[model samples]
Target: MDNFLEIETSVKRVFNSFRHEVDGILDRKLTGGEFRVLSLISSGVNRTTDLSKKLDVSASHITAITDSLVANNFITRHRSEVDRRIVVLELTEEAKEFVASIEQKKKEMIVRRFSVFTEEEREQFQELLKKLAEN
Candidate 1:
């Protein structure tokens, strides 16, 4: 394989491993689509149309995720006062707590992983990653 393709494949493998490891350790059952919707709601209250645009998904797909989240009690809908027909989606406190717990576990796991690298190596790796991300 070409060097660029090899790097791309390695990146994909790492991403998949990270997802599987974190999901297994946190015991969070969210599918990638569900997590994307939850992430959008966590950012702020948004109308379904806006969420569909932000997520780059079909309107019907966004509606399905919102409906599932609502049914699961992870999100709640509020009618806009000025525009009675418009509804906004907001994450519930319970969902926030669930997200927090999952985050905490992931942080712990990352911290444990950090122990494998020397302090200087870790710092340099982080700095280089931040620089790469900026580009």
Candidate 2:
């Protein structure tokens, strides 16, 4: 029980710290929810239903994020020609470039954070994270 609690606490601390850094990475232009939805669309998860499922959030919550994205001109929503009932989200050219730049900055930050560890240690850390993700 003690070991599990310690692990959980440490995990939460690390996660929170990373999330804080992400806000800086976003430069206050968007919230975490907004960035996540955009990232999902960038990754080909265009449907609102799909995004809600992927993010484990309510449809209304996704709608709120999408609404903000639309208002900010980061995304445009349209119905699929084959399936008018379904809405598709697309990143504007401006958003595409923004996402790309943010992604690069995030990658650099992660690399710098992990650079202190030896190569073997980093590989082991990655394997551990992958195992947790898979389960």
Candidate 3:
């Protein structure tokens, strides 16, 4: 029990630290929720229902976040061809480019944060994380 608690604390600390670093880079332009929505849209997650279920967020929350995304021209919604009642969300060209830029920045930020670890150590860390995930 003590070990599990320690692991949980460690995980929370690391996750929060990384999030703070990313927030610093984003300059308060994007909240984590907005970033998540953008990433999902960019990765081909198109339906509001699908995103809500996949992210385990409330429908209202998803709607609120998507509204901001739409306002910023990061995403647009259209009626589905097969199901007129269903709406499909897609990234605009500008949004696509923005997503790419943010992704690159995120990668660089992570690399910079982890650069103190030797390559072998980083690989080992990844393997351990994978193993933990599998369990």
Q: Which TM-score value belongs to model 2?
A: 0.93
> Residue 57 in model 1: shift from native, Å?
2.0
Q: Could you tell me how far off, in angstroms, the CA of residue 19 lies in candidate 2 after the best superposition?
A: 0.7
lDDT of 3 by residue, 58-126 (tens): 989999999998998888999999989999999989878877888899999989989999999999999
Pairing residues by index, what is the TM-score of model 1? Answer: 0.75
lDDT of 1 at 65: 88
- Clashes per model (N, Cα, C within 3 A): 0, 0, 0
Scored by TM-score, the top model is 2
Give the lowest summed-lDDT range of ten residues in model 2.
1-10
Off by over 4 Å in 2: none
lDDT (CA) for every model shown? 0.82, 0.95, 0.89
Q: Which residue pairs overlap in candidate 2's backbone?
A: none
Q: Write one digit per residue (lDDT tens) for candidate 1, span 39-113.
A: 777877478998889878899998898899999998899999999999988888988887777767878988886
| lDDT for model 1 | 0.82
C-alpha TM-scores of all predictions: 0.75, 0.93, 0.87
Worst ten in a row by lDDT for model 1: 25-34
